[model samples]
Target: MSATATDTKTLLGIALASGGYACFALQDALVKWLVETYEVPQILFMRSLVIVLITGTLAAHFRHPSILTSKYRGTLVLRAALMLFAWLLFYNSAKVMGLAELTTLYFSAPIMVVFLSILFLKEKVGAGRWLACFGGFAGMVIAANPTHSPNLIPALMCIIAGFFWACSTILIRLVSKTETTLTQMWATSLLFGIACAVTFPWIWKTPDLMGWALMIGLGLIATIGQYLLYEGFRHAPASALAPVEYTGLVWAFIYGYLIWADIPASNVFVGAFIIVASSLVLVAWERRSIRLAEKAAPI
Candidate 1:
């Protein structure tokens, strides 16, 4: 591709990724609102139902029915469990924490994914990237302000949620090598749907009209957001798209302020800047490593 064409694709990827994150931020706001009146299981069950229907329908229409079949059933189940738990923690934390602060803290997922990649995938990590990981953690602590009694529990929840999310992300990358994206989506929805179904009887609540609207909106928005995320990676290199994910933080801040009147403190911005810079550095380092590897290969 020409340089101009490449730049255009990159811009499109960034836009798609930014739009996806904005959708996710909106979903988070909805989840926070729903959790105020409904149990987490209730919300998850309804939401996962929607995901299953949408993903299943898309898979049947665009691909073969067998695309829903997976050889990595064990991995898919594990990933689904991890994702379910991660969202549970996130939703619970969102109930009491400022959205911007919670999101900034949760944005630690990419940094955590780096460390997890080294541990599980046996990927090499440079010293600089390792340092960036620590810097990101330090930023997380600053943003979380765990010393404050009220913030401690929610901060810890968000941290653990970030770790789980990182693990799930790494699993997705590994599985995506062999599995279709639609298959991955189907598996997550199927497994999580079963998990939610098991708990639904105990926590089920009758939804009023607004509650029903939010529940359906949650599913549609989440599925579209996920599709946009996939489209982003399809259009551009992940390194080029990573920075776009930070747009979620911007959306979180905006949504939080408008919906809940939540104003993030000064430390939140400082910490978010540190975390974002460190993440971008890691992405740059990874991209350089890939280029070096390609050059080193003999034709």
Candidate 2:
């Protein structure tokens, strides 16, 4: 592709990524609202039901009947389980914490992914990236500011959720080498749906009209967000999309302020900036490493 064409595609990818993250922020807000009245299991059950129906319909229409099947069934189940646990913690945290603070802390997933790659994949990490990783952790601490926030447990939950999320990301990368995107989506929905079902009878509460609307809207929004995210990767490399995902912080702030009148502490902004800078630096380093490796490869 020409340089101009590449630029256009990159821009499209950024737009799609931004839109996807925006949807995610909205979904988080909805979950936060719903959790005030409904059980997490009920919310997850309803949302996963929508995901299964939507993904199933798409797979059948595309005539990819095998999208529900995966060679890496074990890996897929593990990934889904990790994600389910992560969401459980994350949603609970969202109910108690400021959206921006929680999101900034969760954004550490990429940093955790880097460390996970070094440890599990045996990938080499440079000094600069190591510094960046430490810096990202420091930023999380600064954002959390345990002294100021009396309830530290929610922040801790977000941090743990981010770690599980990073693990899921690594698993997804490994599985994606052989499995289709649809397969991964189907597996996640199926496994999460089953999990929610197992717990539904104990926590089930009938929803009013607004509650039903929120539940259905949550499912639709999240599924559409995942589709847009998939489209983004198709248009550009992940390195290019990484920065765009940060726009989610902006969305979180806006929604938090408008809906809940939550104004983030100054330290939260400073810490978020540090974390974002560290992540961007890591992305640049990774891109350069890839380019250097390609140049050194023998034809």
Candidate 3:
């Protein structure tokens, strides 16, 4: 690609990624709104259906040949299942939590990813990394205390979401090791769509105009967010892009406070700061470890 084209692509990728995060924040707010409008299962069903529609349309238009018939079938199914649980719990948390509180707990996923890599992939992580993980969880517990103005139940829900999210990440890593990202995404969408379709009828309800708007918006924005995330990672290394994901927290806090009138208690901010600090520690630790490994390798 020409230099101009490369620069254009880079700028476009950043815009897409940032837009994705904004959409994700908006989707969470909409889900919070829908907690009163419709059941979580209903929302999940509609959300998955929307992704399926959008992705399926893209598949047809692009004539992408390989999908679930790829090498990562097991990983795809597991990831889809885990992420479904994560989203369900996340929506429930949003119902009872401030965006920031939920976000703090959600941040635990990267730390969890570190430990999981050590165990499953046998990636060698060190003591500092372990300490970073402990610190992240500590922040979560501190944030959940009664003194915190943010409700405890939602924080707990967020913790649950974090666990599942981590599991989903592990599954993604396993799949990515063996299959194309696009194919993995396709398989995941298929499995999630099936899972949601199965549970949809139990919690299903016909939405009114506001509910319809919320669900559709939730679906569309979520799809865009997922796409942007993939595109961003495709263009830049995670070491660089990882920090940018933190911006989502800022967006979440902004939307929660300004749009939803969510005034976080003092404890929420304290806990969030700790969590953010821990994440930075983990990032630094990971980068250093990668550098050491690179130095040890033969050039």
Best candidate according to TM-score: 1
At residue 39, give the lDDT of candidate 3: 79
Q: Give the alpha-carbon lDDT of every model.
A: 0.73, 0.74, 0.66
Per-residue lDDT tens digits of candidate 3, residues 43-73?
8777877877877777767776576476666
Q: What lDDT score goes with residue 256 in model 1?
A: 84
Q: Per-candidate TM vs. native?
A: 0.75, 0.75, 0.70
Candidate 2, residue 48: the lDDT equals: 87
Ranking, TM-score, top scorer first:
1, 2, 3
Q: What C-alpha lDDT, on a 0 to 100 scale, does residue 138 get in candidate 3?
A: 66
Q: Which consecutive 10 residues in model 3 have the weakest lDDT in total? A: 236-245
lDDT minimum window of 10 residues, candidate 1:
236-245
Candidate 2 local lDDT, residue 43? 94
TM-score of 3: 0.70
TM-score of 1: 0.75
